[model samples]
Target: MSKKLRNHDEVVFEQLLNPEMAKAYLDVALEEYEQDGDLGFFLEALRNVVEARSGMTSLAEKTGLNRQNLYRVLSPEGNPELRTISLILHHLGYRLSVQPIQS
Candidate 1:
C-alpha cells in the first residue's frame, strides 16, 4: 500500500502542538531574526506558533485582543508594539528575555 503524505503546514502545526517543540522553534526563529533583521520572518514564525497552539480565536480570547487585530499584527507586514508582543507571548506560555551578547 502506498503511504499518504501529510501537508507541510499540517506537519509543522502538529509538531508545534508540543510546547517544548514550539518553544525551540520560536527560539530558532528569533535567532534568525537577530541575524538577518527580517521582521517578517519572525512574525510569520510567531503566527505559525499561534496557529499551532489553537488558532487566533483562542489566543484572542486569552489575550483579550480582537481576533482580526491579532491576524493583522501577525501578518507579514504587521508591526506589533512591544506590549502587544509581550501580551501574545504571555498568553502563549512564553515570555521575552534579554541576554548579553558574548564578546
Candidate 2:
C-alpha cells in the first residue's frame, strides 16, 4: 500500500514518491565501517550482509534506493562515492567510519 501524505508540501510528495530523486534525501547510519578495512570495502561488505538478511528487493523498496544503484554501490568490486555510500549506509542503519584511537 502507498503511504499517506499528510503535509500539503509538494516537495514532500516528490521526495517520498519519486523514484528518480528519493535516494538523495537519505541520512547517515551508525559508525560501524571503521572496524577493520578500507572504508568503501567495509561498507560494501556490510551492505551485502544486510541485503542478504533483509533481501535486496524488499530493502530497496523500503529504502527508496534503486536496486541497480544499490548493486553498483555494494558490489564487492564497486568503489562507491561518498554520497552513494552515505545513502546505502543510512538505509542500512549503518554510519560513517572514524579511525580507531590508539591506546
Q: Largest lDDT belongs to which candidate? A: 1
The digit string of per-residue lDDT tens for model 2 on 1-103 reads 9987665444444343443333233212123343544455554544544443465787788778788877766766667678776665566555665656757
RMSD vs true structure, all candidates: 1.2, 12.0
lDDT of 1 at 18: 93
Q: Count backbone clashes in candidate 2.
A: 4
Task: Supply every candidate's count of residue pairs whose N, Cα or C atoms clash at under 3 angstroms.
Answer: 0, 4
Superposition error at 6 for model 2 (Å): 47
lDDT of each: 0.91, 0.55
Cα miss at 27, model 2 (Å)? 20
Kindly report which residue stretches of model 2 are placed more than 4 angstroms away from their true locations once superposed. Answer: 1-44
How do the predictions measure up, each by TM-score? 0.92, 0.47
